[model samples]
Target: MGGTGTTGTTRRISRSTTAALAVTGLVTPLTLALGAAPAQAAPACTAGTGPYQKKVEKFLGRPVDGRQSTADCRAIKAFQTKHGITPNAGYAGSVTWGVMDLMTKQKAVGTNPNRDGRCPVNKGRVACVNLTLQLSWIQDGRTLVYGPVPVRTGRNGDETRTGAKKIYWRNIDHYSTLYNVPMPYAQFFDGGQAFHQASVSMWNPPGSRGCVNMTKTAAKKYWSLLRNGDDVHIWGRKPGT
Candidate 1:
């Protein structure tokens, strides 16, 4: 994703085919003839409120209606992109569902820095930005929407403010009036501390000016999942602070 562009590419390939390619170089002519099998069709969207759909709905922070909707597809695509799943065609196919299932299992019992104490009381949707780990996560109540994604916070004297905040404003294409830089998907929580798309590498030097800088793709997802006035908790500490 470009700094100012939120679009993402999708790559689709069968999981079995992917496995076949990995073993192709070692196959003999006889082996190829005897072992090669026809590739199966890719998984399609499971639209009804079955077990899979319910799982997807849970991850998306939506009501687990048995039927799939446009909103569900959008959420699925965002999740696929976030986890590097290819051909992010917004389908809750086998691979997509499998990944989501794993995610749910991994998070079923809670994880570090994301316990009950992190979110605020009565706040339904919470954007938890953990500076110590340089990760961001969005959750609605106890359901995880997105993240633990890499981010670049304010540097040195410009450390991102810590504490509870609300996203009071949003600008899809906000340009920094103070620094004259592009701040795409800007969701301002504090005075000037917003979560925006940035081009900086998370592990490198030179961070932002009190903004939570996420990748354009991530910022787009955040913009979609978060609404104005949602709780935004900036906590923990970045290393070397």
Candidate 2:
């Protein structure tokens, strides 16, 4: 309902933090603040260096229980190796950890992206893609998230989905319908979905199907700026401009 704000995560991502939760229950929020950092220098969530991977290692120690953590990446590799589970390549995501949680623990990773604000992208039918719909809360001005975000996209051959409902639905990802997202998290064009990162020229193309796609960075930031009951409107190419 406003502009973009800021905040911080890890279901797991990159070659950093490797602290994994016990496979006994559900995931608790921000419990990996173990070894801990001083405060100020605790690292911004969007500081990169593998995203949540680096930060988690800064706080969590070498090994929790018996898992080994070289850095911030969740101990996916080690755990996978020891327990006979398939080791991860280098990338870490919600689904990765979500699966780990299921095999090791019966917990579901918390969706820290839940927010209390709304995405502000109302440009009156200019034909933009609604890529990421994360926690892009607006503070002032025309600020955009410029960070990680969450969203749902089109399916089948007709990716241009149309509807007006508040749903925290999860079905797409970089592996799914996600193709690309906007950069700098600039929320423009309608109901907070004007993020066009790579392939900038292809945006609003005759074939995009109206769903916003982005790199992990922009997606996560978008999530940190939102809350509940936020109005989200996504429209592009509805005929006659």
In model 1, pairs of residues that clash are 11-87, 48-66, 49-66
Which residues of candidate 1, in runs, are more than 4 Å off? Answer: 1-113
Per-candidate TM equals 0.53, 0.26
Candidate 2 runs further than 4 Å off: 1-159, 170-174, 177-204, 215-217, 227-229, 236-241
Tell me how far the alpha carbon of residue 101 in candidate 2 is from the true structure, in angstroms, after superposition: 48
- What is candidate 2's lDDT per residue for 1-241, written digit by digit as tens? 1111111110222333244322222122222211222222221222123333432232233333322234433343332222222323323333334323322221121332223223233522122123232112222223332322222233235443444433232211211113233233233233322333223212112223334543334333343333333344443322211
lDDT of 2 at 62: 37
Model 1 score (lDDT)? 0.63
Each model's lDDT comes to: 0.63, 0.29
RMSD of each: 19.3, 18.3
